[model samples]
Target chain A: MIDEHLLDDLALQNGLLEVDAKLKLAVGIGAILIGVFSPSPVAPLVIAASMAVCTIVFAGIPARVYAALLAIPVTFVSMSIIVILFMTGGGEPLWDVHVLGYTFTLTTDSANLAVLLLSRTLGGMCSLFFIALTTPMVDIFSVMNRLRLPDEFVDLSMLIYRNIFVLIGESIAIHNAQVMRNGYSTFRRSIDAFAMLAGMLFVRAWEKGEEMLVAMDARCYDGKFQMIEEERRISATGIATATGYLCACAGLAVLFRSFRIF
Target chain B: MHIMEGFLPSPWWQIWFIVAIPFLVLGLYQLKKLFAEKRETIPLLAVAGAFVFVLSSLKLPSVNGSCSHPTGTGLSAILFGPFITSILALIVLLYQAIFLAHGGLTTLGANVFSMGISGPIVAYALYVAGKKASLNTFVNVFIAATVADLFTYVVTAGQLALAFPAPAAQGGLLGSFSAFLVIFALTQVPLAIIEGVIIALVFKYIIDVRPDILVKLNVLTQNTVNRIREAAS
Candidate 1:
């Protein structure tokens, strides 16, 4: 089992991580918004392609890593598209079939809708992938802090983020031990083992929480978490380039919508 | 059973965000009260949030040689209330969106409403009813978890169907909803059952090993714990 934590570490090591987090955040949000609100598939499809290029080329993230990241969402999105495609009703029937006394039909309208949905979803996903590939959660938190989100909420997120790695490590050790003992040999045994593991994890997490509280108190800890924000030079040129690219994407979306070139 | 990113249209996703914001506010208010009452609960809540994250991601072998992930929210909803569970769900969903890319930020509101608000509300309701009915702890937990899991998917189906209704079915929304419900049910039913059993067993173990924690959390009274012990013996 590959350590899931390694995924974030890989993002941190990406070349684009050094880029201003605000820029990446803006690009990501801009792409998603354009993808979602666009009237035609042409713009979203273009955005998807461009975002993928940015993530793979500009970000210097490996193509394989990007592909692996997309595989799950692609599978799920495809399933959903199929549901949209096979939904009975609307427009001329492209294909009709009977199965188990129920008639299934593929209509032109449904097909069009599915195409639009697929493009939009892919475009949005690519934008998100770019952000996940480039920015670490800590930086995102820093941005949130800068945006003046409540201190408690930010602190809670930091605590949860730190402990998630710890709990994952503990879970991996317990799962390995269970596997060595043939804990998952049968369905019944797997359930038993899983339940036992979850119970033990809860107890361990609870104990860890108590210990954390004691440790914090020992340092005269207040109810606040002090975060050290790194000073990054926000270059005007970088911001200008990012804005230009986003404006171009928006311009293309507008042109495509007005032209209706599907 | 997350509604993937870009799944809901602009108005629909925004509507869900608007609908879900109140519950999130209420949850924050509850957390504030809890923190004021017991500062130690802050770390405990963080740990609980982490536990939900780790537990939900675990894949367990299911009946018929299939595999599925557990929601892990019903158990927490029972331990903490639905309001707090909603906050936990928000954190878990955010983490999954950023780190795992399992869910998307745009659809976060919809996902949180379905899995966090609707499921936990139903689970907590069922748990309270079961306890009042004097049902066995294991059976109650099983019912709560399974129903809660099933309800989450049902709500997701509804959200999708509402966004994209089928023209063929006379009642557009109803028809599309049934179509999605049938599609999700094929996988969700068995998964829900498996999750239910897993949570039940875990609840039993907790009752056995650390009833004290439950008592402290006000989930169980001292008299109830003694009765549980007697019944086990």
Candidate 2:
């Protein structure tokens, strides 16, 4: 429930909501691939910056929410890159760190690797967030079906997607009840409370599952779930802008492959 | 430890994608067979998956005065068996990636391999072994959960080390492996223990409330169910 409203709610309300899903998908997936494949940090940094603009401005997602979301991956990537910086060595030493009986130096090569890794993480995450904040799972599921994925898989996924909100709401209610009673006042009590929540949630989910089956059987369900495709034609200008941005990023990557920040 | 997007570089991510596909197909195959035999289980499985998703989002209080999230693989593997759990894990990982930004699409394969496939396999195997040995059920579940959680992180560390080895003179793969392990395993051990305790408690509570479900699913034998009932009484 902590993140209950932030994801799909924003996507549903995005400025790009009425735009063609395929174009958005292409932009997102293509940017991700190009970002990940880029060798130098410059292209990835550029990709990340542009994605921020697209997600924040074009998609009309809240800047504060976007920054908070970016923080999660940035924190993780920064911590891991520190490990890379300390462990690898080559070229001129940039900084020396000593721990226990050994000295670890951050060398030029390691620094470059760290920057590359960080930039890639930023670029990839921004592109990913762009897709996530713009395209909802329903659109992706419909896309999956159109791609000729197995019907059973797609159907199960739709069911799962529908159920996730149910379970999230259920768990939140349970947690609120527990909090009211001080169920988590202590470490031991918190564990007990959480386990109890999980147990109760599982039982309820099982019952819901059974209820769903009965309802489906009552309707005489066959294997088909109707997924409608909205006719939102892709505009030529949209195509031009997307390709222009992607090509600019790709060209920057090729041009800056040998450029080093440090 | 869901690897961040583009963290594994090119070759490693593709390699993991290749490795994770067979398990996905196998899970799908098992799911289809289950659907044919029992259509009701399909909805149950779907709901159970969402249940896992919510379960993992929970912040479990640990003994070390810190809170962490559960992987949900241990309980799921026991309840649904490993193959189906893999599919559930894959979906859960995808949701975590999309909604939570915990993992990403390109690294989805790597994340699936570590959290979904490896953790569940370890948990299911250990649980089977414990049952075969007639080990104490609660204790067995605890151990299985902890070890499986730890092993998933270890595999992740190995994957990272393989992708980015240190200088050969500084011990290369082995060197970076331990470094990443230090970063993950240190904070993870206590968290893993907390996950284990919670998982066991969840299992115990399930047996207490709806022992019939476990018995019918063949997760617990009649003898074991009787033993649990007798012990409870």
Candidate 3:
């Protein structure tokens, strides 16, 4: 599994540091909307390709990291698309088979639907990757706050975000201790070890919550947490460039659809 | 079991988001009420949220040689009610989407509905039923966790089937749902069983060490606790 904490930290230090966080967010969301609404695969394919280039070239994210980030979703999407491919029948069969009194066939319509779904999914993923790889969670949360989400909801999210790392650290420590004692040498032992770890973690979590509350009380914490907001000004040049690029992509997709250029 | 980013088309994703909003609103209301009543609930819910995140992310070894991760929502549903679990599920799902890319922003609604709402509702119902029927604590926890996990996947399969029905099947939605359910069941069944056992043992340990906490959480009544202690002894 990828260490997302490390990835987010790395993203904070990457080349897209100068761009406005909101602009990056807008670009990501815009790409997804376009990918979803476009009539043909042309728009999605183009969006995905361009986003990949921007991430690898402009954002300076490592190609390997980008590929690794995509690998899991790609595998999942492929599995489901394969099911889609096999399940749709009754048209011109590219391949056909009979099993247990049922005809299993891959048809033109199924192939088309599979391709569309794959392109749309990939396009959307690329857009999300651009945002996730370029921006950090704090900025995203700040954006949510700026969007006027309820104070309570944003505050709770912030608290959970901060504590996730703490709990993960504690879990790792407990897991390591158990492993050193050969707690997972056998299947039964593994189950026992896991259960103990879970039980301990639960107890520890409750204690930690109490400790945090006491500490907060000591510091005169009221019900709501105060967050410091950083000023981020959007640039006209960046917005213009993003708009032009999106429009050009849309125009190309329209042309492709009209000309039937697969 | 997350529905990956952009997996559902426009209308389907929108419909799910609309369906999920009411549950989320109710959860927020419940959370506010809990916080007002007990100030400690703030930290408890925060830590519970983190617990769900960490626990769900752990890759456990399954009997089928494929790795499986427990949802961890069943335990939370038993401790907190289903409504609060929905709020935690939203946070966990959002975190996974933004940081881990496991699920998507657009598809968050579908994932939350399956993993957060439907699964926890079923788990909480099973738990309440078990308590009413005076079932053994271990058996009750096991059934709730296992069935909750299975139900999450079942709902996920149903969502997928609804989005893309099988062309070959004459039964339309039902047929497509069965196909997806069967595919998921091959792996999800054994994984659910393993998760159930793990959660049961963990609950048993918690009961043994600190029955007070469970009682404090209102998860176990005094009579039930006495029965459990007697059964253990």
Candidate 4:
């Protein structure tokens, strides 16, 4: 979702705005449809398949990169499934394990449910991953601003997006320093390093906040972070293309609603 | 609770969402005033948001296999009052819904109202009580945590009651609420404790190191709070 180098390169290149707008429209429409239409089992599968096609078509990155990105939410889904399967004990137990005077039953329904839930979540994540991969981060901020999000929130997001790379670098450097001092091979040391990292981040962020405030004041900063909102004329061809894609999605949604596919 | 799509009846969720939109717009408009007055506060809000997002990504074991992240509602409430915290929470929830999928659009309202409004109000009230009683910081935090956790559950219960039909055995409002509480309690109590501890530590550290941060954040007034402390002591 956050590729700093790609974002910087795209921002440098001219004609990126038009590309971003079109991609934004496609992603916006798709996300809305997914949110509204894909409420059941079959729709999620269909969405997943469509997302797979979109990933292949739109994502310039390799399949492995996509898979690595998709692994994040996939892992989360797996954890949820495992927890739910063990806890939700009902419907003709497939297997029962007695542990410490407690009977843990795993049912066929639970297993099926875990798969269903995992697939649905993975489908959503994959679709989102592709959307983020295709759309640059700065363009997303522009879209959010254009979509009438509050200026403060938009500005906040932009700043966070901008500084995230710097912060991540700083965090990595700090981690390396800590590791060099004493290797965090032990579990306790690893946790201690994490806690130290968090505390350091907090302090750094706080100091940065003060410095940023002072810098803004020094620069004769007004309260609002103003960016020129360029008015772009929407070409008829672009509108037509976007409309066609939107109508197809709407059609799919209507068809699914009528048939109760998901 | 991160309500999934289609979990609630479409009509009900749609209705609340519709109702929520106007409040959201109105709230945003009202927030415009605050933005112009104190632009520096934006970074503070951003820091709070970024910290919450970063810390939340680090999931800690709570109960069983269900993990819960720090809501940071108490801290937000302590710094900014509940009213502003509501708007901040809504914005954060919007980002989370659109970007992370941690929470859903339909359920954002209920989540905001619970974590944003109820948690802080309860925490602040507890803090006030603790102040009056001259209680220690840890005691104040524990009280705040317990009250805030209970308050959110109660509000969530009401929401469940509204969403589901009545009668305990029918697997409707009461039954669902009970089931949710039982499931939620497994993680929520521990999550609350973690949050309480973090907030307390942050509060203590801020008081010692950079009291100016809290002062600028409007969490505590310099002279008034000092006077109160001196008198209490």
Candidate 5:
């Protein structure tokens, strides 16, 4: 169960783990914005490539893992891109098709829009991965606190963060037990077993919650949860490098604004 | 099944955020009030939110060998309320975006609005309708959870259609809506049914194991629990 997804483990072991979380967040968000705003696909495609390279090459994330993560959206996105390509109209018609008595036409504008959409999504997802791979949720908690989010919200977020693992661990144990019992030997049985698992999961989590409340109260549970103070000072070089990257992307976007494949 | 990060363009993303903020504020406010009255709810809420995360992670065993995860919003909305479920969904979506990059931060508003806000409301409404109609507990939970699961994707499809209204696509918005709907909503129908079944089974287990918790949470009254137990025994 855990093998399917365990991103925090990656963040903990990343090469850029020690870099400032805020800096990483800024770069990720900046690149995402630049990618989104660019009318052309060129800038977003560049951002996507650069961000993927940074995550895999700079941050030491395994190439296989990166590709696997990226593969998650390929099916849905390709479908979406195709839909946009065939459904949108205007500009020059590049191709025409007659299917089921409907005349479907692909046009220049649609092709350009499809490519742009595909690249923007690619860039956005990669930039998000860059942040996810580089920054641990603990650091993000501190960042959230710094951003003036309510203490209660931050505290609850921390609690939720901690419990996700606990619950996942619990789930894995249950899933294993179910597997051992021949719970999933057939498709129909598997559905029943999985339903039982999902049902019992919340019940188990509720019990865990009560146990945790007792644990916290025993430890003098206060309304406040402490934030990890930011240790890495924001360096001039980090800022300059991030700024340079954002500027380059913005400039590329402007330069290629009118460039189109169709 | 989230609209992966960076899918929605600028103005649409910002518009969703704006639409979602007031609801979030109301949710956060409701949570504060709930916490003030019952201190235990704080942990309960956290765990419930985590429950959503865990639920989403649990893959359904599909016949075709494709993966589909349950939305858990229907169950949560029934146990808690829509207000709290919305924020829980927001938290869960945020975690997915930041850690797993399953959804985009830019599109979190849209995702939350669909999965968190709209799905739960539909579930809650169906639940109330079921309760009023004196429907069987299993059937009630089944329909509510199922339709809610399906409804979330409809909202998502609508959002996409509104955002990307192709001018030349025959019937324009209506035509493109159906096209997008085929991709976003049609595929989800089977998964949604599976989710409903799983959630209905979950409710059965909850009723058998912790009927008091259900009563306390206001999902079912003590009287209804007694009647159900009487009928069961």
Candidate 6:
């Protein structure tokens, strides 16, 4: 079902922010309710399917790229489940495999458990991804501010986001510097190199902090952060959509629970 | 831990949302303090940028083919303090949530609580504790790094417990905690050590070469001898 049509939809847009914010508020509440009240099997798949559909329709990204991006965590979750399922010591053992002083037994429940976990994780990630990809950063912060979060929290979040890239660049430089000088191609050498990299990164960060403090004091700063714009209010339509989506998700979860389908 | 959708009972997540709202509001209000006197924090911003960027590249080894990265809020906490650091952490989490999918939008509150708030507070607390006792700078940073990592993992464990409850009451909590602890122990210890060493070395070099800058940031005092004694003692 993963197709190429969705691939072209990944482009960023002005409306994407509204769509994403609305979806997130809706999905976040909905998912939690479902997690608590809904039954298994059907509930998990339905949730996953709905998210998949959203990713395809609203994410504005190619389906393949979406899949690829999702694969990183999904793969980890799936593998963990697989290892857990087969290695677990319950249910009818299909076979026993001994490796590295450990015995792994495969069972039906384990397989079922694995599938269930993977499906839930993938579905959840994809849905959340859809919202993030669609929404612009500033607007999301605005929405949080509107939602009644403190101004400091919002501003700090902005600062953190701004600095992340800079920090990553410094980390890479330290890493590269280690590689060039230490030649950490071997396991032990790599560990030493890694230690050195960590050491260098911290030293650089502290120095940068010192320089930053001087700059701030020179400008007469005293621990206050201010943003340039006014906060945006949530529209009625946005509120309505969020409410309706949440209600539907809750209703569906309740319905599934009543049916007792696990 | 990023709680996937439909994992925790809805009520729990809602409660977290509620708890987070006020803290967030208070944080916003305090933000003015970070720049109250119309001071330029561009230098701090630059440092923040560099710190986060470098942290991103240092991956922790975990389950096969998987790795977890330190939130790195500990160092941020020490330099920027918690209130500002929390918000900054939120921003970092937000970007990662969108571009890298390392976190999710819905779980932003939880992530903020863990990496943003708790991590830095623990780190800062350790720094204060060390300072009170007159421990060497390296010892202080190392202990802070270690404790911060442990506390962050504990917070992560609490979050995961919300997401997936243990099937049985007696053994479930222990099982879940152990599962996560095992994974964290495999990865976080080395990361903390590295981070601690990094902070100490950097702080030392800064003191030696750029005493004025440190004093400006309030990291070091205008009296150089006192600062050295502070570090040494």
Runs of candidate 5 exceeding 4 Å displacement: A1-3
Runs with alpha carbons beyond 4 Å of true place in candidate 3: A1-6, A257-262, B226-233
Point to the candidate with the largest lDDT. 5
| For every candidate, C-alpha RMSD to the true structure in Å | 1.8, 1.5, 2.1, 6.0, 1.4, 6.6
**Reference-based lDDT, each prediction:** 0.85, 0.86, 0.84, 0.57, 0.87, 0.58
Tens digit of per-residue lDDT, candidate 2, span A1-262: 3543438778888988877778888888888888888989998888899889989998899999998888777545665787799888899998888889899888999999998998889898998898889998888887888889888788888888899989888988999999999998987898899999999899889989999999988988776688887767889999999899888888998998888877
After best superposition, candidate 2 residue A40: deviation in angstroms? 0.6
- Candidate 4 i-RMS (Å)? 6.0
Per-residue alpha-carbon lDDT of model 2 for B88-197, expressed as tens digits? Answer: 99888888887887889899999999999998999999999998998999999999999999999899889888888999988899999999898876668888888899
Candidate 3, residues A72-122, lDDT tens digits: the string is 586467667877787755557788878799877788777777877888888
* Docking class for candidate 6: acceptable
DockQ for the candidates, in order: 0.66, 0.72, 0.60, 0.18, 0.73, 0.25
lDDT for position B172 in model 3: 69
Model 1's CAPRI class is medium
- Tally clashing residue pairs in candidate 6: 38
Best by DockQ: 5
Q: In model 6, which regions exceed 4 Å deviation?
A: A1-37, A57-60, A74-119, A141-251, A258-262, B1-6, B18-26, B42-50, B60-66, B159-172, B201-211, B220-233
Error of 3 at B92 (Å): 0.7
- Chain A TM value for model 3: 0.90
Give lDDT tens digits, candidate 6, residues B1-233. Answer: 44444333355656666666675566555656545653356445545744664464356432333455656677677776777676666666666666566656556777678777787888988887887787876678767866786787678666665454443532455655555556555555666655565556556655555566556656545764365857666
lDDT of 5 by residue, A1-262 (tens): 4435567889999999988999999999999889888899999999999999999999999999998998877867876777788888899999999989988899999888888899999999999999989999998888888899977788889999999999998889999999999999998888888888887888888898899899888988777776559588988999999999999999999999999998
Tens digit per residue, CA lDDT, model 3, B62-148 = 687655678899999999989999999999988888777788988999999999999999999999999889888889999999999
User: How well does candidate 4 score on lDDT at residue A214?
Assistant: 84
Runs of candidate 4 exceeding 4 Å displacement: A1-18, A22-31, A34-41, A61-127, A163-200, A228-242, A256-262, B4-9, B15-30, B61-68, B97-101, B104-107, B145-168, B221-233
